[model samples]
Target chain A: MVNRMILANVLHRPIRTAVSVLAVAIEVGMVMLVVGLCHGLVNESAKRVEGVGADILVQPPQSSFLFGLSQAPMPMKVGERLEEIPHVLAVTPVLFVVNSVANLSVIYGVDMTSFDRVSGGFVYHAGGPFQAPYDILVDDVYAKANRVKVGQTLNLLSHEFRVAGIVEHGKGARLFIPLATAEDLQGVQDRASIFFVKCTDPAYGDDAAQAIHKLLPKHSVLPIKDYLSLMTSNNLPGLNYFISAMIAIAVAIGFLVIFLSMYTTITERTREIGILKSLGASKRYIIANILREATLLAAVGILAGYGGSLIARRAILAAFPTLSVELTWDWRFYAASLALIGSLLGAFYPALRAAQLDPVDALAYE
Target chain B: MEPIISTKGLKKIFRIGKVDVPALRGVDLRVQEGEFVAVVGPSGCGKSTLLHVLGGLTSPTEGHVLVDGNDFRGMSDADRTRFRRHKIGFVFQRYNLLPTLTARHNISIATHIQGNGFNPHRFQAVTSMLGITEKLEHRPYALSGGEQQRVAIARAVICEPKILLADEPTGNLDTENSQIVLDMMRELNRTFRQTILMITHNLEAAAVADRIIRMRDGRIISD
Candidate 1:
């Protein structure tokens, strides 16, 4: 009976039903795209951090300055002191500077030997480890995107570095120069922004993080996973505000459409309801009929919305590859929640009108 | 035989500002089991009001309605709905078939609402008996007035209610369609022993009934 009723209602008003479905689909698609982009950003950033494979990352108290804009570099002397602590094993210094890719190359600088110790071995394919002051490695994705070749000299801030080999690291960006070259260009002799520490035993990761925290109370010592999560949450506040605003607007529009559609449906059916009541159909049956129609519309809208999300993901990816958004099934939560809300809100007025109709008055409406 | 439906001094009043207009004024009526009865009157004559009160669709301000000896005045609103669903069937003049459902599904809905599973053979039998078997799969919009009314009749009688209440069951039909509907109602009464109470303004429509009651000015002027 429900199936028959739903089919009937859908068939009766194709234009209205299609419009409702499109509204829901757009909402679902928006939510899917938003969630997918956020997830992608977090995943990519974490891959960069994990590429270093550090048990714990130790940075200067002022190192957070790199989070937003360029700042005075942290002194490299901090890495030396942190390595002297007991059971430290080894510490690799890290330098930070946003190098622009003009013409065709992205340049990053890091200490070649210490970087290898920290990562066990840099996952590289074309170029061997950094051997010269200007030697650097570019990952395959960046190389392909930029159309650059090995042994290429890229100028950055008046310094030229040799791209010794093309390297492929798991989702990490390219290295334009070795650590020494970056320090030389920045003119900071004793300071670097971060230290990547390798514990003698992987099980000692937490202990190492705690020890670093105790050693340098002013600086935050974060485990690899926690650091990645912190980085992911950094942009969450702004994203949350944006999402809340968009969702509120979407909900308002959804309700307005639903209200108008349901109102028209009831108004059109007033005479028919009278006829049913006169035939011995109770108010309960009438209300059920209206609600059943709303539910049917909602279900169709949700399915279309879900499908729209897939289309949205593909479109976004095609338009902006750098957005790096990957679609996932987790987005269904938003679709389901919004769909239920839409159906309930849409059905309320129609149900009330159907239930409260006076058979005599309704029949006289014609 | 005792009355299947009995109403005594049933009064329904509508309030407009400071004045109260009576719709059913001290009405007394009884419908015997298996009887085909019609209450006839002009527009605004309270004939429909009397039918509503008898069918438990509306409450009277000042009287009692006893259905199969059960006092409707004592039943709760939910109980009244339940009683209406189980003991009463309704046929409307405009043939209020849900525009979405096919004729067969329309009738099946009533039985489904009664929480009974679909019985294909029974539905086919009912439609065939009404000579609407060919149009059973057609939606209300696709069927003619007479076909739609037959589907309405099938919907009303599918649950096999103890009493069928109709309001202007043939008022929207032509004379030919009206006669067909009346013939169906007569067959239902004679073959199924179903008690029927109908309201109509047409005297010719009322002529098909076993008994006719007339109303005027919210009161029964003749029976």
Candidate 2:
């Protein structure tokens, strides 16, 4: 009977219930989307970097695991010396520019001869390698997204470049240009952000890295296979804190909305509460009923949030082809739990206040 | 037999800021088991306050109260609430049936609060006797005043409490509905031999009880 009353009370005020549920749904969805985008981008970028077929990577001292964040470029001669290491088959100088034209993207500048040799050559879907210093090579995904053809010109870094080729994606970046042109345009001539060394055998990767590290004592030299696993929010500075703060803000939204909703509902139901007490409802019983309503609302909101997040992920992927939003089950569980806990806490005080109401006064309440 | 209800020096004072306004002034009262009693008074005459004190809804500023062999003074709030659940049932003037629930659920809530499972036999018998069996599926707003009050009466007596407390049970009803409600109370008292204590301002409503006690200025005037 009490359960029926709870359900009836929840349904009695549909608008209030909807507002509360929507607030909770937005909170859960916000947390899931933020966490998903952060993790998805990092994992996607890491996989693309691994696709370069490099066995070893070298960067300037104190450079981050994220290639795009490497601010100080190392001298291009670093690639020449890396090729001398034992078991190193080829070395390529890659100077990347983090550009924001239509969207945020990293355009890698590579020396064609060494890049082709190190990456086993690009599998062209349309045109071939860069034809001129002003030519740009785009991957299939980028070409399809931007609707670019072989001869179409694109403005990158304030310079016009003709599209020379459309290659299969997964070669470190979606867009590429010749190394010399990139260095000249970027004002980093004779310098590269990273040196990608391809080894004769995968097993010689660590040895090549150790040899390179000994030569450039202060620089960062890492075996690519192992470094791929290190590219996570946990390993990245400030990323985890950023994600935590976003989740906290989401939970706070749920808590505040639920608190206000339950408080006002309790106040409005003062007379009804008196009726229940006069019927012999204990404090625990009253509290249980109130919390039960909150939990039911949260449960519905969680399901809505899950569905909304999936739809949003699909829409986002369609609108922004380069952006990856990976919705993990682990984060889904965490978001649901946080919403439930926050909602429970929000309803607690109002339940207590209702339970403490004097039966006589509550009965007399208008 | 010892009285079913006994109160000594029952006094209740409302402290409004610095002024102490007394609602029940040392009024001692007693009623036997299986008896119907009505407390009657005009506005500000402590009849409702006396009913509240006897029902354990509020504590009297000065008093000793014993009902059905349980001492109200020795019981904690939890104990009183439990006692109310099992031993006392209440009906109010406004027929405080939860407006959101169907008439059936409104009555069933009292039985639920007693932590007792639904008894189909008792439910049918109670609702049938009160003539609310056909109205059970309707919410309070759809029910007439007489029907709503009947539902409230059924809710109170469904758990078969030892005592029934009513405050102005017919105060909000039309003359015909008030008469119907009064007849049901009389029937409940006679058929079940239930102990009933009612507070009312209507002399006609008070006349239905076996005994009527009148009060004025917080003291018993006559019986």
Q: What is the TM-score of each candidate against the true structure?
A: 0.86, 0.96
Q: Model 1 over residues A1-366: C-alpha lDDT tens digits?
A: 666666766678889887777776666666666667777866765676678777787776655522324356567777887787766788877666566555332345677777778777665667666678867677776666556687678666666767788776552345546677777777778666677888888688888788778878988677876767666534555766776667666656666676678788788878767656655566677777776776667677777877777777677656654445756665577656776587668778787887788766787676
lDDT of 2 by residue, A1-366 (tens): 666888899899999999889988998999999999999988888988889999988889998877778888988777888888899999988998888887878899998888989898899999998879999999988887778999999998898999999999898999999989888878877999998889999998888888888999999988987788898888888899999999999999999999999999999999999998888899999999999999988998899899989999999888877788989999999999999999999999999999999999999999
Candidate 2: DockQ? Answer: 0.83
lDDT of 1 by residue, B169-188 (tens): 99889999889889988988
Query: Candidate 1 chain A, which ten residues in sequence have the lowest lDDT sum?
Result: A62-71
| Chain A TM-score from candidate 2 | 0.93
Of candidate 1 chain B, the 10-residue stretch with the lowest lDDT total is B76-85
Q: Which candidate number has the best DockQ?
A: 2
For this target, which candidate reaches the highest lDDT against the unseen true structure? Answer: 2
Docking tier of model 2: it is: high
Query: Which pairs clash in the backbone of model 1?
Result: A25-A305, A75-A191, A76-A190, A76-A191, A108-A176, A110-A179, A279-B90
* Tens digit of per-residue lDDT, candidate 2, span B62-141: 88888888888868888888888888889999999999999989998888889888899999988988999899999999
